[model samples]
Target: MHVAEEQKPAKKSSKVKWIILLLVLLLLAGGGAGAYWWFFLRQPPAQAEQAATEADKNATKGAGKTDTAKSEGRLTTLPPFLVNLADPAGRRYLKLSMDVEVNAPAAVKEIEGQTAKVRDAIILLLSGKSYTELAAPEGKLLLKNEVADRLNQILGAPRVTRVYFTEFVIQ
Candidate 1:
């Protein structure tokens, strides 16, 4: 029958549309999963653990071998800094704890020797920032770079290559 033929084509078209829609949805889900893995899970847990172990060994062993530390990198932890932000309300404060990555172990000793000066410089810089200035990700990154530059200046060498904020809190 003519009507039956028309109904069959309509049913086929409807099924095709559903199949296409399902495929599109599957593609979108796959893309989202891929992006999540790329951003958050790119580093495997085993690799991170191994790197941490290596860092510990380097820290302990390179304390006496500046050449080894210089060849690679050394992480030096700094005492946490708690400073009042230069906000209009004067009610905000930031508590930050970080590790400085230096090119040499001598830089670590230099930082330890100049702890007072280093703390002073960092405190001043941190206190000069307003709450809004350090609230965004870009602002935090800028602060990290600025802190590295300041540390290098204090050390009188371009030793401080990176600053990793282990704990950052602004309130």
Candidate 2:
């Protein structure tokens, strides 16, 4: 009876040791994952703040420039677009708003005048895209280029220099 009691305690201790080791391993794995996310996956707010400050300074500097020079780097924001993605489920949707930068200020007025056509073209493009296509950074960069091309086609010239997505949401 004494030997049996001793064996039972040994078994219990072994099990406790295994559980403690598993918990430690789990804690270590969780800490590594958290550190990876903090260092890699998270966007730095400080960089964005610095960019904003730089833009403000640029605007201040450009204040003294002539109207044509000031308008040369003008940007025109388009209306938000909501469209269902071309996924098999058909339930996925994307909502997007973007600002288009033109090479000259005159192109801004052209874009505004042709807003309906621009929206139509963009809506069709967005609706045709699958969720997978716009989910990656490379895909987004391609989308920007395509958008600029489409805008240029509508404007009958390569007036658009860049497209900046101000809002992008997928649901």
Candidate 3:
């Protein structure tokens, strides 16, 4: 009986030692993962601050360049002209009128010399669209960009800055 009781205490002590060892291993693993996240997985705070500073510097530089370019007279406004489109449904045709601006002198001269061709292109583009399309802001902006792009291609330069709709009416 005495020997059996001694054996039971030894078995219980071994089980308790194993439980403690398992707890220690779990704690070590969790601490290692936390240390890795802090040191390597995450970016440093100073780097994030440096990136923000660089972005601000770039924004300021861009603003300065734009201001200087505008002061140097890189902008020019073109005279408004009304263009007529052929209407297959009736005798009367649609008319579109808008003012355009071109930044390059060479492009301006090219556009002036090829007024008939430019007008024809504009008329064709405008005539193909319905009144509802022209009425929307996004559609009008798209049309302006398309006109600028086509005119620039004909002029052979990226000179057109904007196309303004001074007058727009469907009849």
Top candidate by lDDT: 1
Candidate 3: C-alpha lDDT:
0.72
Candidate with maximal TM-score: 1
Query: By descending TM-score, how would the candidates be arranged?
Result: 1, 2, 3
TM-score on alpha carbons, each prediction: 0.65, 0.60, 0.49
Worst 10 residues of 1 by lDDT: 64-73
Q: Give a tens-digit lDDT track for model 1, residues 1-171.
A: 989998998999999999999999999999999999988988788988988988877787778854433355799999999999999999999999999999888899999999999999999999999988999999999999999999988988899988999999998
Model 3: lDDT of residue 66: 41
Candidate 1's TM-score reads 0.65
Model 2 earns a TM-score of: 0.60
**Candidate 2 clashes between residue pairs 3 or more apart in a chain or in different chains:** none
List, residue by residue over 95-163, the lDDT tens digit for candidate 3: 455666777556666777888888777767776766556668898899889988887787778777787
lDDT of 2 by residue, 25-129 (tens): 999999999999999987699987987877876897788844334444678999999999999999999999999899887899999999899999999999999
Summing lDDT over every window of 10 consecutive residues in candidate 3, give the lowest-scoring window.
67-76
The backbone clash count of each candidate, in order, is 0, 0, 0
